[model samples]
Target: MMNRILLSVSGVLLLLVGTATLLQPHAFFATEGITLGNDPGLLSEIRAPGGLLIGCAIAILLGAFRQSMTQTPLILSAIVYGSFGLSRLLSMGLDGLPSSSLIAAAVVELAIGGLCVVFLLRLKPV
Candidate 1:
């Protein structure tokens, strides 16, 4: 099902991202630095998100393994993707310099979120 694919893709993305962050937070920060926007301890927050992403990725993979994809998982994944894209858009509009990579990421996130929503709508009662 599309839901399954969405969940798996999100899981893979998150897993790789988390691995990248866990292994090379410095490299990521160097490449795409964040200044906390008047908020303190931004580095700590950046570090914290990685752990959450890794955990969610693992859970998603497990859910897929059980062939248990459903609205809950798909919706949650969509929320994550959509919120991230929305926040990035807002940040770019209000603050933080936008780069090609940032724009590309936002586009992909929005696309995936849209796909998840469409699939959720198309799903039959179960």
Candidate 2:
């Protein structure tokens, strides 16, 4: 119930972000405070992550609907979000605090990851 809603909402957010990245990498990068220099490989690099994230978003949305049949995708979602948050934490330790927008992103990543973990725990044996 609540878990499913949470998963679906998170999935929707991921889907929107992923889609935006795929369609408008420059705009996405700008919002993230990144500047894609005039490197030949830059677009390729951007598109690669876009494709991967789109795939992940799809899997997460599917998992939201089929929570009983497939916990694996939800598990992967937790891992993905956790990895992003943990990596940001590591960066904070190594590079000091980032700008406020990036800090906000880090917080959102951590909160979403934590929510996913809590939902996983509440899942009953079926």
Candidate 3:
């Protein structure tokens, strides 16, 4: 269930973002569909990773919550995604207004991370 959720969400996000960046880097930057690191060189480097990252994220999500699969990915998502969300929450202090995309991104990330965190934290040792 959780795996499906992540795969559906992330898979779509990855494919859309990857294609968007590829088709028009300037347009994406203009509308803030994606934001790269501050420096142009850094942004270029960052862009390089997006291509396969989204696909990988989808795969990981599917693996994490398989009915009888390993727990490591779930554990990782709780930490990594949750921290990304926590950072977004903190970013609210940085500016009074953030872009709509950022807000939406933050919301989704928090949802994914929050679910992972709650489930993982609630687990008990056998």
The top-ranked prediction according to lDDT is 2
Model 2 clashing residue pairs (backbone): none
Kindly list the per-residue Cα lDDT of model 3 for residues 54-120, writing each as its tens digit.
5555555565457454355566556556776778878887765578778788888788778766766
| Alpha carbon lDDT of each predicted model | 0.76, 0.79, 0.62
Best by TM-score: 2
State candidate 1's TM-score.
Answer: 0.82
Least lDDT summed over 10 consecutive residues: which range in candidate 2? 67-76
Residue 4 C-alpha lDDT in model 1: 71
Best of the two (2, 3) by lDDT = 2
Off by over 4 Å in 2: none
* Candidate 1 residue-wise lDDT, 54-87, digit = tens: 8878876665566655667677777878888899
| Candidate 1 runs further than 4 Å off | 33-42
lDDT of 2 at 89: 91
Q: What's the lDDT for candidate 2? A: 0.79
